[model samples]
Target: MIKIVVDLLGADKPQTELVLGAIRAISENKDLYVYLMGRKAELEDFLANVTYDESQLEIVDCTQEITNYDDPVDAYHDKTDSSLIKGLKMCRMNEDIGGFVTCGATGVVLISSILILGKLNATRPALSVVLNGRNDKPFCIVDCGANIDCKADRFVDFARLGVAYMKTLGIENPTVATLSNGIEAGKGSDVIKEAHELLEKCGFNFTGNIEGKEVLDGNADVVVCDGFAGNVLLKSIEGTAKVVFDDIRRAAAGASDTQKAQLEAFIGRLEPKFDYNNEGGAILLGVKKPVVKGHGAATDKTVYNTVKIAYGLAKNNLVEKISEEFEKK
Candidate 1:
């Protein structure tokens, strides 16, 4: 059985959506077990309205709540019994528990995971996010928003982690690239220049530096960069998607009925490609166990997908593989 701890008390939406989504997921996968942690009253109240097999769901009472406005570090420290903390603690105690999923503050989740669960080996946990691409394969971006300033060695480790992830997902010999303003080896900053040489020396398939524009073109299987650069790239993609979608919506308004229908269909096809919620958030790679950090404003679907991603990580023994790779370096 795959045990998953879910922090139901987090997120902006009513807790009912999370409960309902969990119910849907559990019903679909009998091998899965969920430990829902949240306020006793709030959780019970929500459960009272839903119909589910009691044997499959376990509720742990957590009176304290972590709000969006609270400082992430302070929230984790002050609210020891917060749903997020409880869920992480449960995962830590139970070896059988595959992973911990939370829509809580990203900072809190990342820090708590590192503090309680610890890192996989010597690697600083990176926020590895899946980037939507034209091909069936999903591109993995490391340090999406985790380590703002990272050393050249860290970037090399990120490359290894990214390759392991892609391999687990069935992509063999994944091409790794560093994000840069130009494709030339000498184009980026001193850090990138050093990272380029180090990655080239590494045994893995390095594709040299990849320009920002070519990222969406599916030029590389794994993209490596410091958190600051990775976060900027991620936000740029999001912002561009939003702008294009808004323009499409406005254009649809002026089209004929048939034309509008076609436009909507096209938008529908493109929407999922850029929807971060659909892909869940990013994985905190290099941890001893799989830890997924969902968006603070994550919905039921996003939470569900996060659970699935965790399950995949555990089943594939991703952490173990990463450990072996790190040991060799």
Candidate 2:
């Protein structure tokens, strides 16, 4: 059986909703055994009301939870019993535990992952998320808001991490590219220029630099960038997609019935591609174990998807594969 630890605190959504997601996950995957860490009485009450296999679920009693208001560093040091901290600790202590899933504060998750799980050969962990590109193929971007000021060498590390992740998704010999202002090799800053050269000789299928617009065009299977640029790029794409979709919705509201039907059909087909709930969550690669960070506003459906991803990565031995790749360096 594949075991996963899920922290049910520190999200914008209520605990009950996240718990429901976990229940859904276990119901779907009979081989999955989830350790749900959160308030004990509440969790018990909620579970009692639901009909699920008792063997697949275990609730760890946690009195405290890490919140956005708490300093991530201080919370890590102080909130040892918090759901996020305890859940990760559980993952570390148990070899059978495949991975961890949490809709917790990103800062705390990143810190706890490094401090608790440690890194794969001490390489920096990059947060990566898969997105459906314009060409209808899925692509992943590394360092999406973790390690904001990465050095040039770190970009290369991100590329390897991204490649390792994509390979697990069955993308053999995935093409890689650096996110920059222009497609030219000299388009970005000194870091990009230097990293560009390193990536060329890194032995992966490097496709040179890709502009922000080219990212959605699926120019590369993996796009590498510092956290600052990556985070901005991710949010920009989300924001743009939201604005455009909202405008279409407004226009459809007043359109003829036939036009409305066509617009609704278009949105139904396109929206899931950009939805965070469906994409599961961002995977924190480079850690010793798979750590999935769900969006703060995640729903039960999001939790289910995130747990599925964590389970899949753990089953695939993502950490060991990544370590093997880095050992070649």
Candidate 3:
């Protein structure tokens, strides 16, 4: 069975909601086993009301919860028993455990992952997520929100991480591109220029620079950037998608019967494709194990998809492939 550790606390949503997501996952995949880590009473009370395979689930007792307000460094030492810390420990100690899932504060999760599981072959971990391009093909964005200040070499590292990730998804020899303001090779800052040169020589199907507007045009299989810029781009795209959909919904509400039916059908066809909840969370790559981080405001659907993605990562040997790629350096 593919075993996974899920930290049920520290999210903006209620613990019971995440628990329901996990149960949903277990119900669909019988070969999977989940170790749900959170308050024992709450877990037990919630599970008592649900119908699931008791043999496939385990409740880990955790007394403390890590909050966004806690100092990440201090919480590392103090909140050892918290769900976030304990879940990392479980991943580090057990070889059978495939991966971990959490909706904790990003800072604390980063710190604990480094301090506990450590880095693989001295490479820093990058947050990577696969987003669909205009042609409906998927492309990966590395360092979505992990490293705010990155060196030019870190861009190369993110590319390598993205390559490993895409390969795991069954895309062989994925093309890589550096995100820049303009498409020309010399259009970006010093970091982009240096990274672009390095990517060309470092190999792995390095394409030329890609502008922000071209990101979703299926121009490249992997787009690499620093966390600061990547985070802004990600949120902007998400906000824009939400606003556009809301406007469509509002228009549909006031439209004539025929127009409303057409608009509603149009939305029904496209809305799920852009829904963040269905995408689950971004995978933290370059670490010792796969760690998926979901949004703080995640709901039951988010957790269910996150668990499924985490399971795929573990089953596909994502961490081992990443380690092999870095070890070649």
Candidate 4:
């Protein structure tokens, strides 16, 4: 069975929907088990009336909650009983537990995971997200937020992790492209220039430099950059998606019922491409185990999909395979 740890404190209310989603996940996946990490009393009271197999859903009480205000370092040492820390510790110590799902503070989780579980095939763990490409295929971006001030060599490590990550999803020979101001090999800053040389000559299937506009054109499966740039790119893409989608909703508001129906159908097709809920969340690639960073404002649907992602990752044994692949080298 592929075991997953799902943090229950991300939701705003009494966690009714979150608990329901957890129950649904286990009920659907026969061999799946979820470790719901939260307060001892909270979960007890929460799950008391809920209909679910107690055996299938285990609770690990972690009362202290980590907030964005909490310093990563302080929270790491002080908030040992916090759900974020406890969950990471669980994934680190238990081999049966293959993945962790959390919508907690990104800084705290990333720092704690690296300190507790250590790195797999990377210098420091990176935030990796699979974005839907224009051609309907998904591409990955390593170092989306973790490790902001990365070195040229760190970008190389990101490339390696990105390649193995895509391969795990059954994509062989995934293309690698360095994001630059221009498509020319000599385009970007000194760091990009140096990294470009290393990627081209360092046994990677490098497709040369790619401009910003070409990123969504599906020219590459992995667009590598420093965390600063990568994170900016990610937020921009997210904002654009929200604007575009929200605009569609506004346009449909005053339309006729027929037009609204047509728009809804079209939106249903477009949601899988732009919805964070459908995509689950970003993965902390290069960690010792599977760790997913869920959106803070996630709904029950989003929570279910994120946990499903963890289950899928564990079932596929991707983290173990990546660790073995790095060890062989």
Candidate 5:
């Protein structure tokens, strides 16, 4: 059985949401075991409202709840009983535990995972967000919000990690590209230019420089960038999708019945391909164990999908594969 530690008190929604999600996951997989960590009484109260098999779910008592405003590093130092910290400790204590999933502050989750679990090799753990492409393939953008300033070597490591993830997801030779202003070889800032050069010689299937406009054009399998640039690009894509959909809705509001139907269909077809919440926040790669940092406002469905992702990572031995790649380097 696979044991997963969940931060039951982490989300902004009612505790019932987490409870329902856990119950749903448990019902889906009979062999999966859940160790729900949070205040005992609150968890128990939530449990009282649901009817689930007692054998599949177990509650781990933790009194303190990590708030959104709390500094991540400070919370790790001060709140020893914080659910996020406690969940990581639980994973460390038990070799049987396969992964840890948390729908809390991203900063706190990253700090706690590093502090408790440490890095897999000498490489720093990076936050990798999966972006959906046009060809039904998901490309990973490393350092999505982790290390803002990165060196060429770090970007190379991100390539290896991204390739490993692609393999785990059944993509054999994932194409890599460096994000830049133009597709030309010498088109980016000093950092990107250096990264592009290094990637060309790195023995991976690199496709050269990719511009922001062509990110979702299915041109590259993995797009590498510094956290600052990656974050800006991610936000821009999401923001543009929102604006386009909002305008579509407004235009459809005053259309004739037939035109409104067509507009609605178009809007439905153009909706953002990737659901960030549905896939959890992002995977913290280059760690010894699988750790997922979920969005603070994630709903129960998002939390459940994160658990599935963690399970897949553990089952595929993703971190171990990354270790092997680093050793080869």
Candidate 6:
């Protein structure tokens, strides 16, 4: 059985959203076990009689909740008993536990994961995110809001991090590209240009420079960028997806029934393809343990998917594979 710790107190919605989602995940996989971390009183009072296998579920008692406004560092010390911190400790202390999944403030989770689990020893931990790709598989972007300002060598480290991630998804020798203003080698800042040069020599099917427009269309298996650029790119993708989904829904609503049926079928397939929920959330790579962050507005479906992704990461032992790649003495 795979063990994953979930921060039930972290959802932007009622904590019930996260609680029920964890229950749904447990039902989906018999081998999966979750330690739901939150204040026990509210959870039990809300879901005391909910039917579930006793063996698969466990409620870890926690008192505090970390909010988006909390100064992550201060909260790290002051709110030591918060669900986010407690969940990280659960991941670190339990060898049976593989990783943690949280719908909390990303910054707080990032801070606590490092403080609790520590770094992977070779590389500074990075946030690796999976965005919509042209195919069934998603291309991963490393440093998606972790290190805003990064060095050229860190870009190289991000490349290795992205590579390990793609392999776990079963993409053998995933092609990589450095995000740049222009496809020409010299178009970006010195950092990107140098990173490009390094990527070429670092092995792993490194393609040349890739423009932002080409990234989601499957131009590369892994697009490496500093967190500053990656964060902007992630939101832009999210916004565009929202706009497109809205437009498509409006169009389908007015169409004739036959046409609407066809449109609905197309959208049903396309929605999951581009949906962040199905992708779960961005991964915190380069750390000793797996950490996944979902959008704060996550629903029960999104929460369920996040746990599933974490389960895949833990079962595959993704962190250890990453350890072998960069933890060179």
List, residue by residue over 266-328, the lDDT tens digit for candidate 6: 777777656565558889997778898888888877778889889988888798778766754
* Evaluation by lDDT, superior candidate among 3 and 4: 3
Of the two candidates 1 and 3, the one with more favorable TM-score, higher being better, is 3
Model 4 TM-score relative to the real fold: 0.92
Residue 329, candidate 2: alpha-carbon lDDT: 80
Clashing pairs in 5: none
lDDT of 4: 0.80
Candidate 2 has which clashing residue pairs, if any?
none
Would you list the C-alpha lDDT of every candidate in the order shown? 0.83, 0.90, 0.86, 0.80, 0.81, 0.84
lDDT of 1 at 294: 76
In angstroms, give how far residue 309 of model 3 lies from its true place.
0.8
* Runs in model 2 lying further than 4 Å from the true structure: none
- The TM-score measured for candidate 2 stands at 0.97
Each candidate structure's TM-score, on Cα atoms with residue i matched to residue i, is 0.95, 0.97, 0.96, 0.92, 0.93, 0.93
- Model 1: clashing residue pairs? none
* lDDT of candidate 3 over 201-289, digit per residue (tens): 88669888998888878788889999888888777777788899988788678679988888778776776556554678888888888
CA RMSD of each candidate after superposition: 1.7, 1.3, 1.5, 2.1, 2.0, 1.9
lDDT value for model 5: 0.81
Q: How much is 209 displaced in model 1, in angstroms?
A: 0.9
Across residues 1-329, which tens digit of lDDT does each residue of candidate 1 receive?
88888887768876667767677777877888888877667778878888787888888888777877778778767888898887888888889888888888778888888887888877898988888776645888887889998889889999989988877787878999999989999989899999999999998789999988888888998999999999999888888888899888896787899998888887877876676766777898987678887777777887788887877777787877787677767
lDDT (Cα, tens digit) per residue for candidate 2, span 193-290: 99999998889899999999989889899999999999898888888888889988997787899988888887878876776546788999999899
How many steric overlaps does candidate 2 have?
0
Global fold similarity of model 6 (TM-score): 0.93
- The candidate that wins on lDDT is 2
Per-residue alpha-carbon lDDT of candidate 4 for residues 1-329, written as tens digits (9 for 90 to 100): 77898887744534556667778889899898999888777678867887777678788887688888899999999988988888888888887888898877788878888998888865577888888878688888887888778678787888877877787777888889898899888899899999898888767678988876777777989899988888787777777878988888897899999998888887768765665545678888888788887777776776787888778777877677667546644
